[model samples]
Target: MVKRQAQHIQVDLQRQQLRLLSGDACIASYAISSARNGAGESRGSECTPRGLHSIRLKIGDGLPENSVFIGRRPTGEIYTPALAAADPGRDWILTRILWLSGLEPGRNRGGSVDSLRRFIYIHGTPDSEPMGQAASHGCIRMRNRELIELFERVRVGTVVEIRERC
Candidate 1:
């Protein structure tokens, strides 16, 4: 299958949705989970930072769906219901990962608001986790299959904008 180049991604924090766009066309839309703490621009706040960002890196290109990731590196364990049940409180990062870095200075890039330092990413979560709601530690979370489809359609340096509303 020929893949389409993604132009940009808009993340609506208020609605808990992520949209992939190409010019005026809406390529795909997926339910996403943002931060439980709402939106802010400070490290350690556990909040999703607002403003423009880009996919600095794309990890798990060929990794299996539900492949576990920690610190952007695969841990060799695939996510399963039993594993999730064992660690109910664990912040699960699964499948593909789209690591994001802020572009706007002070507001989201530098000092205490540096998104890269905050380890912000758009990644996958367990199938049991609910989407279209704020439930993540900081990163945006999507379903494994949906995330894989998105990951294949985008590349590093793709623009991402996170906002409180549409």
Candidate 2:
């Protein structure tokens, strides 16, 4: 019999990568899109907040890939190229979401620095969106299929550390 170490997530803002690690080994690595504004903790900064966080909620289980979400709820709309063309400026949140809450107070948590209040999430982006670079408004974005796979592996309350490097 084998015992598997519990998995945790790490987001490297500088590399624009996200790694799923179990113990000292990396179980999976994926290209990610972080924030265009870089790293910060203030509300409306549109920057990725850096600190210890956890998956406060896991959303979109059983939902189809490319399923659209707004305010953390399914919008009954599946993303399509035509749909994207119709509203090109829309901030797309698709497939799955891992809502994050900061563990460190006065940094990523509480008041203006509250990541949860900022609606920081690890969610899916359109296939047309480029990864491996910082482009998100604030959240961590991944490919739809990749996000779904990650969502299946991680549970609510999984530790997720976001930093300049993993």
Candidate 3:
């Protein structure tokens, strides 16, 4: 049997959108929140790296919506407004997580610019948080339901290209 080509994701930093594409056609598009610090590839920069990347892992499968995750592990707490209120300063990683690794050697991968070392991800965010904006610390933030849907559709090794299209 021939292996199917993996679908690719295109993240437009300027538009704050993530599009899933198969071949040349767009399969899905979602409003997303990227880095408020903007795009870069340096460790400790807290900025989203711009380049070709791939899903290194997919987490939170079969988990309920609003499921809370900390350090890539489920925290056994579902996200609630009260919970959010209690930890207002916390950067919530909810529902699902799509961990990414940069494909480029120096631009976003390896050494000081390693995206995998940076722990970059496309993850779920609080419902109160707005999308289609640059608000995250460095990772891509999606709506909880939207992220679950996306997580179901994508697999590890899917290509993700993050770019700033002016």
Candidate 4:
């Protein structure tokens, strides 16, 4: 039996897209949101830390769409317009989540901009969240349906590269 290496994940801030690359070929691409203020290489800055990372945890597997999650745990309630309206201040995390950990030591790991310590993730969001736009508070956000598919395709230890557009 052949052992297959995990796919690589790439997030291009300029393109506002996340790509799943298998070897040298692109397998999937989806809209993504980075930091609102732009990228950085520090922890606790609420800025999207740059450099290489890995999937530290994959949360909310097998969950239905609109499934509510807080701190990465299912809340057991489906999202609705009414719920959103009632808690407009909520930073909604829905569908699926892929928690990321920084690989660089001084640049984006174990410091203020540490992606793992920063709780950065590529997660599902409400459709209302704008795509191809920089609107998140440092994490990457995708549509619920799209993220569900991505969550299923990727695995822990998948490499993630966040880079500026050239």
Candidate 5:
């Protein structure tokens, strides 16, 4: 069993990178894509809510790559160029998903800006989405291979900090 610990996951939107940290030491860092509309704390705004949060639930462990999902349930079919072409407009959320919940109650937890209620996740995406660029509805999207590796390193209740570039 993976013991849950309070680790830090820092996202630098300006740098388009996600850094995993244990205390003051850096564990791993990878390129990431945040909300294209920029970051904020608002519901139905399709913007990435910024501030302190934690991994509420981690989903799709041991699942096959490219496995289609809607509402977090497997659709039992792997993603392909053909399937992608069929639905070019579809935003592919694949592989693993780290569902996030905001720590701040009034800021990002309850009400419209609730991160959990918004289904915000750090999930795998098709390679088509460029790394180091803002291009997601609200969640942070990472490449499948990178996400799988990341998923193995973290656990539920991991701390995630998102702040505007200073």
Candidate 6:
């Protein structure tokens, strides 16, 4: 029997935390900022979808820390406090991206609820942004360094379980 990949990554929404696990043991923990609109399963809801998902794509290989991305492509810009002050309304996707694909059928997979279609990702944010709170439009937001570390550790198909509570 194959031990499922689901146990490797866990997101506790209630705590605004993400864990990197080895079997039942946690290898690392990172504070996260989830959807400010809370949890839901709909495209354009601006809320995090709760379910089993896989890291469908891991982007930003060989990029510098705080490298900026838009539309999943590097924009030839590195994030800086000055740049942020210039474009205060910009929803920054920095460092790396772990684009997610939902595993559940109707809940988060197909139709309007599809996470991939929704462009849901676990990506990095500017360090100035607050962590350990619900703040993002939809994506799971992490600090750049932590996200870089996680991006290095996990594979493309690693399963992630996002939960509403512990």
Please list the residue runs of candidate 2 whose C-alpha ends up more than 4 Å from where it truly belongs after superposition.
1-5
How many clashing residue pairs appear in each of the predictions shown? 0, 0, 0, 6, 0, 0
lDDT of 5 by residue, 94-115 (tens): 9989999999888789998899
Q: Write the per-residue lDDT of candidate 1 for residues 87-130, one digit (tens) a residue.
A: 88999999988999998988889899999989999999999999
User: What is the Cα-based lDDT of residue 110 in candidate 1?
Assistant: 86
Q: Estimate each model's TM-score.
A: 0.95, 0.95, 0.95, 0.92, 0.94, 0.96
* lDDT by residue for model 2 (1-166), tens: 2233377888899889999999878999999999999999999999999988989999999999999998999999999999999998887999999999998999998999999999999999999999998998999999999999999999888888888976
What range of 10 consecutive residues in model 3 has the weakest lDDT sum? 1-10
Better of 3 and 4 by lDDT: 3
lDDT of 4 by residue, 10-116 (tens): 88998899998998688998988888878886655667878889899999888899899988899999999899999996768899889999888877688576788
Q: What are the per-residue Cα lDDT tens digits for candidate 3 across 78-144?
A: 9999999898888899999999998899898899999999999999998889898899999999998
RMSD to truth, every model = 4.1, 3.7, 2.9, 3.3, 3.3, 1.7
Give me the runs in candidate 6 sitting further than 4 Å from their true place.
1-3
lDDT, candidate 5, at 73 = 85
Candidate 3: give its CA RMSD in angstroms: 2.9
Better of 5 and 6 by lDDT: 6
lDDT of 1: 0.92
RMSD score of candidate 1 (Å): 4.1
Please identify model 4 stretches exceeding 4 Å from their true place: 1-6
Clash pairs detected, candidate 4: 42-112, 42-113, 43-112, 43-113, 43-114, 44-112
Instruction: Looking at model 5, report the run of 10 residues with the lowest lDDT sum.
Output: 1-10
